[model samples]
Target: MSILNPLFEAVAWVIMRIHAWLSVPFGASSGWAWGLSIVILVMLMRLVMVPLFVKQVRSQRKMQAHMPQLQELRKRYKGDKQRLNEETMKFYKENGINPLGGCLPLVAQLPVFWALFNVLRAISDWQPGTTPKYGLTIPVVQSAKDARIFGASLADKFLFPLPHQTLESRLVILAFVLVSAATTYLTMRQSQKRGMMQQGPVDPDNPAANMQKYMMYIAPFFALSGLYWQFGLVIYWVTTNVWTLGQQH
Candidate 1:
């Protein structure tokens, strides 16, 4: 029903095809195959955005280089917000810098995340023997319905445990949530450390510095919202966060 439904369907199709291909060589359970497909999907998505990530790094470095000038501008135009905005834009243009460059890659990835979320939600809600409107084939959906990993279905979630709701499922889901939250926090801390190394020590009073500080908490809080998300999606999140951890390290 949403405008993004078509994109979600396309992403789901790709995931299902990849899972089918991987299943041929890996005689693992269907749940594991589906989980691997999600991991691969995240890797592929990140790979495609490598150039944008590079651009983000460059932009951040440029901002770091201009920090002194930016601070002076803030001091000089402390009261005139309109003039400050104009001067900031001019400064960025003169330096060939994009203020939003670091944000662009993150913004671009949002749709992909949303698409995956919907695709996994569809799988999570599918009943055995029912036809899925997107993603896997009828047989695959049936397999998914019966699939369980460590007694927890890939489609299960803390907010909506499957019909079984066994102790093992509860433990697995809890572990996934904790790991996801921890990785997210680590990623933010790592990014902040790198920024400090490049930009010098941040002055806590600066608005930009304060915003970055706030972001440390905000990102992890958002990650925790995945407690309600499907385990399949949690797998994707955990894998992606791990990739980021390795990449940043």
Candidate 2:
């Protein structure tokens, strides 16, 4: 009944298709098949998002380039707030500069992230004897539950692995969460440094500034999320963070 149901179905369908194609070559139970499917899915999504990212970057660079003119306008209209607002609107209209450009890509990305997480969660929640909703087949469910990378089931969580999973697999899950969390923190740090350099100072109470600060402190602790996230979802998070890091460079 929810509008998001379609998006969730689309995400599951894409993952299912990718896994089917990969399973043929790597074998249905092979972790490589599922892992590669997830990796490839991220690449595909990011590829589609590239144009939006490019546009955002271009818009930011353009704004930076025109800072001097904006400063001049501010100076000219210092005492006249109404005129300043009108002139700002005119400037934006003439220059085709969209103040909201930076938000479009981020906004577009949220649903994709959410849907992917849901699909992965559904698979991870499926154990050998359990069934998943969303029309996932028996073979699909079996393969996902059985798939193992480095002795660790993609369905395994770091904090509370199923009793059937081995200690070695538990260790691997721990490592995946730790590594993924570290990588994410590093990526965010890089972004924060870059943004600070580009945007200069801002008010302490600004939501964006506060968020940057909040995430900086919490980024390392993000590994705790592994308590709930499946190893497969960890793969998605780490891969996407790595992709974002590369883009920043």
Candidate 3:
């Protein structure tokens, strides 16, 4: 009945396996190993989703191509909301396009995102000699608790600094926050710019355009919000954002 339990167990097993494999090369400093394992997890997830991403890109292009027709439909049915909806659906059907396809990638990622969160939370909350259904051993959990990247514990958050947080931890947290925000903003800005270039600049008063502009600005705030997440998750996020930027390019 609990989705989180199963997802957490699956993700934890994969993470622990990755950590174990990497530990051979990087022993006591397995914090970096764990951090990089998250990066690899992101890469693996993205790779698996590549086909869907392609569909999303193609859907956007098709939608952009039909923008003029859609506008015409809107004007033609300005007097009848029901007719407009019917016509829009008919048009999409005829074109072999699903307008909602653009959202598939984001929607699909939510479960995996939560799974990753649960896995990290489980590790952070682990008690001595206690092992969950996930394959992570007691020693693994202990090592994860002590895992540090650039002298900052992987479990520490920028907003909730550890009592003995050092200067290095603060600096590293700052760096991660800035990079995450910058990457998010840049990626969204680039997409907006491309859309503008293709669509000849969105009208400032257009409701849809206004919404897109708002999203462009508001979405980057997630990076600030992510400051509540563990530093390891932050590293995963930065890596994912960087990969997204490259993919978008």
Candidate 4:
């Protein structure tokens, strides 16, 4: 099976049930159900990843505590790049720290993220006059369908008043997109700040630190642009970022 298949099936099952439950009380036209489903999906994923997140945090703390020693080793081996790498790796092994542990939560989450992205994209593509499949039915087999959120159809609108064109949808989308981007940046800033506090000032000349700084700026742009692709997914990411920020604190 594909890496994302399990996550796709799990989210599809849960969200479909949620859609059904909401449909009973508010009817299918009530877009609130869809919104709630997305929120719940994000929550579930975060909960499942919590353990990995905790481990990552612990590993980061250990690495930070050893930063002084690591720096000395770097200076001692500066002229021998390969020896420096070997020494650094040996130190990390002896200390039982995986520097990459800081990224484990995110690495583990990619499959789930893609799964939900595809799921939401499918829902957005559902069309009118088509026999709508019920309860966890995947949307790819069909052609040219449109799904709506409130007055906005998922197919056309990048932000909101949706596809047919309304100022309201456009404003809503813009507002959410800005909020998402800002929140994401704030989250990254907080993480970097905390990491720096724990690890001390990274070597200005360090390639890894420079790469991280570059990502700090570049990532938000990619995240913000995603708002055009699917507003719901943007919300999910924003929510997750907020959660991560809170966890760090």
- Highest TM-score model number: 1
Q: State the TM-score for model 4.
A: 0.80
What is the per-residue lDDT of model 4 for residues 1-249, given as tens digits with 9 covering 90 to 100? 466566677766877776667767655545566666667777887898999999998987897788888878978998999999999999999989898998988898787678777766656655645543323453321311233455443334463324466765566566666777777778777878877776678788666666877777777777667556565666667777777778877
- RMSD of each predicted structure: 2.1, 4.5, 2.3, 4.1
lDDT by residue for model 3 over 1-249, one digit each (tens)? Answer: 475677777888788788888888988456678778888888888899899899999999999999888878887987898998999999999998798998887787778778887767777777776674466677777888788888887777777776777878878887898899999998888888988999997865455667888888898888887778778778878888898889989
1-249 in candidate 2: lDDT tens per residue?
567878988878888899999988899999999888889988899899999999988887776666567767877887898998899889988998887887666688778778877776677666566667566777887788788989887777767677777888878877877777788788778867876788776446344456877887697786568657777877887787788889878
lDDT at 46 for candidate 3?
Answer: 86
TM-score of each: 0.90, 0.74, 0.89, 0.80
**Cα lDDT, model 2, residue 134:** 67
- The sequence of per-residue lDDT tens digits that candidate 1 reaches over residues 1-249 is 777778988898888788788778764356677678888998998899889888988888899889999999999999999999999999999999998998876787778888887776776677666778664677766666567767778778888676767878877987988899899989888998888887778886589987987888888888877778878778888888998888779
Q: Is candidate 2 or candidate 3 better by lDDT?
A: 3
lDDT of 2: 0.79
Q: After superposition, how far is residue 130 of candidate 1 from its true place, in Å?
A: 4.3
**Candidate 3 vs 4: which has more lDDT:** 3
What local distance difference test score does each model get?
0.81, 0.79, 0.82, 0.68
Pairs that collide, model 1: none
Better of 1 and 2 by lDDT: 1
